[model samples]
Target: MKNWLNLTAVAASVALLVGCTNNPYTGEQQAGKVGVYGGLGAVAGAAIGAATSSKKDRTKGALIGAAVGGAAAGGYGAYVDNQEAKLRQTLLNSGVQVQRDGDNLILIMPGNITFASSSANITSSFHPTLDSLVLVFKEFNKNGINIVGHTDNTGSLQLNQNLSNHRALSVANYLTTKGIAGSRISAYGVGPNQPIASNANEAGRAQNRRVEITLLPPQQ
Candidate 1:
């Protein structure tokens, strides 16, 4: 009973300490993937260690497990952080918005800048921006790329769905041509189903028509 209590206390302490960190971009305290993964790992490791070790060695086992688990999870956080920094620098003033959601990085490309109106064809001027993306993507090859196309509700559902899918495919094809591995890429379309803004006005409709490239870590 005492050994179990000790293990629980250790796990809780580690989680609490590692869970809260300052966000570099926002300069505010945010609960990020580092905290989430580290906490989960510590708990799992503690339970496993307690179950496997002899009574006399239980505490030592729990400590070692917690350390290993925390470190392994924390490494993923560092990997994404570096990649985000590179992307922000590379895409500055390029009209692409870089957003961070936990360990994932989302690159939002507005349709007006990326493709012709109501067409799947990419704009000629966007090639340079994409070229810059290719350079960074090639350098950060560890992440999986997910290309999703969204459209405003200006047409029938079927039409919007087909158009969105084609747009997503076009972006994926472009990336593949620039040396990004086909195996690392997946493209899909949500049409007007996942709009970020209302379709009642042109401004909001414009916001809805976009292509999003989300970068995922290996663990995700």
Candidate 2:
């Protein structure tokens, strides 16, 4: 019984460690997808080990299971890391911001670069950028894409909502035309409700009025 308790404690400790580790590329303390998966793997491994092993081999079983879990988690981390590096290089100085959240990559496209004021039509200048993105999307075909449109609180709620929805649909439609399967893409609009910055100033408002594309990994 003591040995079993000890093994369980060790597994829990490993899970905690993975869950709180720093992100290698961003140097930020994020509860990354790798961490979450690793942690869950550890716990599940320990449980399976305890269930299947003889009393004398319980510790060994638990350790082996934990190692396997960590390895699977590492594979996913590497996949996401490669995708992020490619995106950063391709979007350099393109007025687009790439942010990492857990296992997801978010591309923030400011309204100035994506569309004209109060218009749903994409800017002609942004076509090349979208073309580049489409190439990457084709390369990383497994990841799901989510496009969300946001607007500043300058207009009526109804107007903003309609505009935001139209902008999101426009982008979604463009991606479809470029050969991205519609099944892999989901688009939506949230007008002035999920602001990342204050609407008190022009700069803040500009930040608020943006479109975000998030790349999500396949579920394990």
Which one wins on lDDT? 1
**What are the Cα lDDT values of the candidates?**
0.86, 0.85
Judge candidate 2 against the unseen true structure and give its global Cα lDDT, from 0 to 1.
Answer: 0.85
**Candidate 2: segments with Cα more than 4 A from true spot:** 1-44
What tens digits encode model 1's per-residue C-alpha lDDT throughout 38-153?
Answer: 76677677777767889888887777777677677766766787788899999999889999987789999999999999999999999999999999999888989999999999
After the best TM-score superposition of candidate 1, give how far the Cα of residue 90 lies from its true spot, in angstroms. Answer: 1.7
Work out the TM-score per prediction.
0.85, 0.81
Clashes of 1: 0
What TM-score does candidate 1 reach? 0.85
Clashing pairs in 1: none
